[model samples]
Target: MTDSQRTALIDHDVWNGGLFGGADGRWYAADQTRDVIEPATGERLTNIGVARAADVARAAKAAAAAQPAWAALAPRERAAVLRRAAAALERNLEDAARYIARETGGILAKAQLEVAEAATQLHIAAALPLQPQGLLLPSTAGRTSYARRVAHGVVGVISPFNFPLILSMRSVAPALAMGNAVVLKPDPQTPVSGGFLIARAFEEAGLPPGVLQVVPGDADAGAAVVEAPEVRMIAFTGSTAAGRKVGELAGRLLKKVSLELGGKNTLIVLEDADLDVAASNAAFGAFFHQGQICMATGRIVAHRKIAAELTRRLIDKAQTLPVGDPASGTVAIGPLINERQLRGVDAIVRASIEAGAVLEAGGTFERLFYKPTVLSNVQPGMRAFDEEIFGPVAVITPFDSDDEAVELANRTEYGLACAVIGASVARASAIGERLKCGLLHINGQTIADECVNPFGGRGDSGNGGSMGGPADPDEYTQWQWVTVKSTAERTPF
Candidate 1:
């Protein structure tokens, strides 16, 4: 395809066939095609094939058929393939980042970081196969017994539009490393960056056919992946509402599931904190990526003594953040993914204001570009404090004491991440320990992740299943117990 055909999102020629990669080493055509709209410009960037339930089923069957052979390879062989894939991603990093920025309305820097993180995830997954995969068990005389981790045959990954590259690869690379085939269904809004780019990298790395398939679609496609008989596990990243449905269906089918869901993360600023540092962290935490992150600070709990001054500084910061097309590589804040998301965010801000929260900085937008907004006097019962407004809006609520700060932080049902800013790290950590969240940050912001850390949430956020680091083996494989005898035992029969 020509550059103009793809709307100049990237300079690549691999998308000549259908968008959906099938099991037969060919891109399969579909009856339907969906338009990929650029969030910043509201223009059709490109159109790609849309996979339905039947298409997803075909991919799953192919993955199941191809898994055994792939798993039979030596560990080093698999690791080498993963390392090569990582290198391929690094080689095309700039193009991929530009594609991501144009497609998702994320700034260039965020897109670049996401692509880099995806490569890092591949590198991390490369090392997983070389690690220990089993344990020896006690056995009787003339008998040997052990337990080993074995592939689950096929894994289905459903990724969201926000941070598409990293979220999808975090599951895909690890599953492939553990010797399982994957059928990935990236969000329709970001098919190229979330699915096509991944397929290209692995294909260039010489991965065998049918071992990985990329199928982009909407809810029907996702449901098909969960229901496919050939798939043994599901890794999903999206809203808590969607995640609940995925978990319920996967559970009924007895499929292993890893869910990384929604969050209403909190950032607490103590009375002794440096106002300048606290304000900067607050801006980054609440406004980064237009506040589309699951770990974005939904609410800021500040000590009453410094609440007014902190709010003033936050307003100044919010007013200065430039909002526009991210493709220009100048704006700090970009548009929301779509019109529906923009409406949802606007509704929350209006309702919170109606409930007595003061809109201090911004409460407006031009097209999909929402201004970085600030609201003070927010309380626990208000929508601004209770709901997950996945937009560039920061709500501040003051607390009289440390106990009250912890109470306010833990008020919501969702508990994904929380941050505490204080003069002393030890004191902040002590306060953080009292809050309910899967990830906690001291003297930092809530938005943070490393390749070596287990990532997930609790309560409405997740079902205790995590990704990355030590959780990979358990999440991608099933345990099998084996026993052997040196001599035949006497038959009781």
Candidate 2:
């Protein structure tokens, strides 16, 4: 079969069986539907449901209906189910990975890595039930005071198009392990990979009906999931504009939310840094998945002394990058997810050029394939430097001093992640500390290192919550308090 044919969307019960909902592991596929198109070839791969508000209502109602019983299950049992799902994901990782490569337009090796690591994340999150605890207040002796970490009931998960499998688990797996039923609204661009595959995993793993629902769709379908009053909390990952509206709606409804929004993360390459390392990191930052990353390195502050050299090497490295047929084992970069993303990349490139930013390399957009772009002579003030260019456009700005580099890196509203490539670890860390990003790496690029720390961002790049630390997802859903008083009776006041 041709590589193009390898990534074709496989038919599934979610569509063919009139499957609008899944409860007790039985799919009730009776809903309004649509087509799942291949962004790479503009081909209609298969029929997929564009679930209506009523359909969403039925699914959520089913979840809400079943949540309490699921919650009643032993935490160990919950953990066991999650472990089973994780195993099932591992079993089908190849199937899911290929789908991810096709549906999301990410390359083969990277898609395989994403699928494999996403399985690990799910497995890790599945361990949350084992970590649930009650903290005792060190108040008065013999006065029973402790806080229970409990599920927030029905939870809504809204994931974006890029990195669908990984991002989807970034929210839903934790919710499920903590005994909360999940209503997942995976990005329409990644239905087969993230949404459909996830449901299949849970189903094969014998997960209870209504505990996990993967509803594939657009913003409206997501709206249906969010507008449900029974949804106790929402965890969203996507654009800043969309996130704002989601946040506002959640606020009006008084529902708790966790948002992982857009970013214009910068990479700083100091004069003292290794030029080769800087070039490679920058390339990986912007070229991975064609830079559709929310935390991808959008801007670079390279030392003027080495800017020309690094720019040359970056372009040389990017030039050799393989493109086309994401399911092909050898393709390095794939096309944009759809025309919307393709246009967005084009607009950013055009605006950058109009703003007088120099295009170093890869400013070409052909069909859905946007070349890996590198821009030099970029101003820190330009939109290309400040906006989240969710494409492979690397806008490089030069700075004379280390202080200027730090200032340039921290100039954006996004405090997602940033890096300092320097000769001295001490100097790099010092610069990293001064920068205003949630994650700061030394001699590396800003990317999601799944096991290290909190992967979300800050400011316009992140959502409102007291969860600034690198705690597990279950930790955020818990509430803790302490009461101090004597066990002996006190006189009435």
Best by TM-score: 1
Evaluated against the true structure, the overall lDDT of model 2 is 0.77
lDDT digits (tens) for residues 246-302 of candidate 2: 999988889888888888898999887788888889999988888988778988888
Error of 2 at 196 (Å): 1.2
> Where does candidate 1 have its weakest 10-residue lDDT segment?
1-10
In model 2, pairs of residues that clash are: 18-29, 18-30, 19-29, 20-29, 24-209
Global fold similarity of model 2 (TM-score): 0.92
lDDT of 1 by residue, 280-353 (tens): 99999999999999999999999999999999999999999888999999999999999999999999999999
What stretches of model 1 exceed 4 Å from their correct place?
1-13, 491-493
lDDT of 1: 0.91
CA lDDT of every candidate? 0.91, 0.77
Determine which window of 10 residues in candidate 2 has minimal summed lDDT. Answer: 1-10
TM-score of 1: 0.97
- For model 2, the stretches where C-alpha displacement exceeds 4 angstroms are 1-14, 17-23, 464-470, 473-476, 480-493
